[model samples]
Target: MSQLELRGIRIQLRSQSSPLIELPELTIQQGEIVVLMGPSGSGKSSLLHWLVGDSLPEFDCSGEIRVGGVRVDALPTQARRIGLRMQQPWLFPHLTVRENLQCAQRGTETPAERARQLQACLDAFGIAHLSEQAPDVMSGGQAARVALARAILNQPAVMLLDEPFSSLDTATREEVRAWTFAQLARQGLPTLLVTHDIQDIPEHAQVIYV
Candidate 1:
């Protein structure tokens, strides 16, 4: 329901260090993708952390992060309702794939409604068969898909993906990237993706080199 917004953003590793990434503003419209690329230590991930209200202890930032025109910089990580998927699946080692997705459905929807939504997410990600499987048993591509499904199940207002497809083989990476983009497009979620690989950039995306 909201696009991602960052205004007057400046991030410093230390108070005395120069800003790593400074931006007057950056916006990703609904259903659009923004590819954030930069050299090592240039703070691409730091920008995402800042936007999600979880700046690392080594960093200090000044910015106004808004979703749907409402400031969320002051909100707690969970309160912000921002979705994130990293290079690893990061699913609970103790839970099955279905449980992982169920745990992410923390919204106010009714139980019946939530179940329907969860099933749809599993089906959409093509992981219905893996629902009862443990996360450790899944292949790289399957784990990535599980992560994507969990993120989508959360129904985030905006999402930040940090090399979500990096861990896959070339062919698998391409397939998962296409599937992920398709799902994101279907939901019209404003997403910021960080990657060093140019192939990961979707068509007509806005790229920001930090």
Candidate 2:
């Protein structure tokens, strides 16, 4: 289990002048789900960007992002161990689901072990049958599940969700949202979910309004 804490964080975007966002303090314990809800341009997405060490080139940020007690601001994005799932379900159009999972496998020793890990991840998300399918052939909900499976295959310390459920119909959205949250809980990964829809949140989440 891993913990994530943000202390005295401030982020600013530089154009000619600076636009800033200040956050007092926030903490998310291991295995907890924290939802950040706010309207567009309220700095919700920027907060995630800062945490994941992928703040846009135009932004200037000063803050402390600690994951499992390690200061991550100075670390590279891959070293941050944060998994991000965005609304677009950004899987490669050219890769099969199995290939996508393979891409996220972090330093598994042997080919067989890597295959086993990928299989387990697909099974966990109930999409093992779709492993050979191309991304374009999968349904929206299925693609979302594959995206999340790929994210967790890396065993990230914390998962960042940026309105992942926004693109589906009500029924599909509800199903995928439930599956995504359940997988996060089972993996015991702390999660930060950013969404505009309150209805998509699971009952167990601790919500913070930005």
Candidate 3:
């Protein structure tokens, strides 16, 4: 099972002497969700970016990021096996739901296998019926599911969620939040969720205050 490890994490703006966030170490085990809770500007998102190796140049970050015991902090964003889902779905405007997901998958599998895999992911997200629909035509929840499907198709070792449910209506937010956590757990992903809302915390989840 793959686990995510962060060691000696520290982040600060280049012009600032005080660090915004500092942690000696943190570990997210397989099938676990660790919620990072803090108000806005608390460096929750910055920490995630550092783990993915995409921290803004204006920020000074130092950390040892590892996945399944393999160090990956030195890798580029695309090379690090990390999945990120933000508040916005960020789907390509012109692509159909199916097409958007298709672009995230990469493998040497045959065409038929690839199609099957894509279809399975869509079904798991409860979005198979909307496969041919455009993102513009879908509800906020539907679009979010498609975005998550695309992320899952990428098959990352660790998942990072930056308030992914914050944009949805209350009902939709509750439903989608449950589904997302369940799905990620089923995949045995080491997940770190960043959110300011206490309601977003799942039962039994490990929460860290920033």
lDDT of each: 0.87, 0.86, 0.90
Q: Write down the lDDT that model 3 would get.
A: 0.90
Best by lDDT: 3
What would the TM-scores of all predictions be? Answer: 0.95, 0.94, 0.97
Clashing pairs in 1: none
Q: Sorted on TM-score, highest at the top, how do the candidates line up?
A: 3, 1, 2
The total number of steric clashes, by the backbone 3 Å criterion, in model 2 comes to: 0
Give one digit per residue, the lDDT tens place, for model 1 in 70-131: 88889998888689887788999899999999999987899999999989888877899999
Of the pair 1 and 2, which is ahead by lDDT? 1
Winner of 2 and 3 under lDDT? 3
Residue 70 alpha-carbon offset, candidate 2, angstroms: 1.2
Residues 1-210, candidate 3, lDDT per residue (tens digit)? 789998999989888989989989999999999999999998899888778877589899997999999899898887788999987999998999989998998777899999999999988888999999999999998988898889889989999999999999999999998888888878989999999999999999999998
What 10-residue stretch in candidate 3 is worst by lDDT?
46-55
Off by over 4 Å in 2: 15-20
| Model 2, span 106-200: residue lDDT tens | 88469888878888788878998999999999999999999998888888999999999999998999888888888888888888999988896
Query: Local error of candidate 1 at 151, Å?
Result: 0.9
Off by over 4 Å in 3: none
Reference-based TM-score, model 2:
0.94
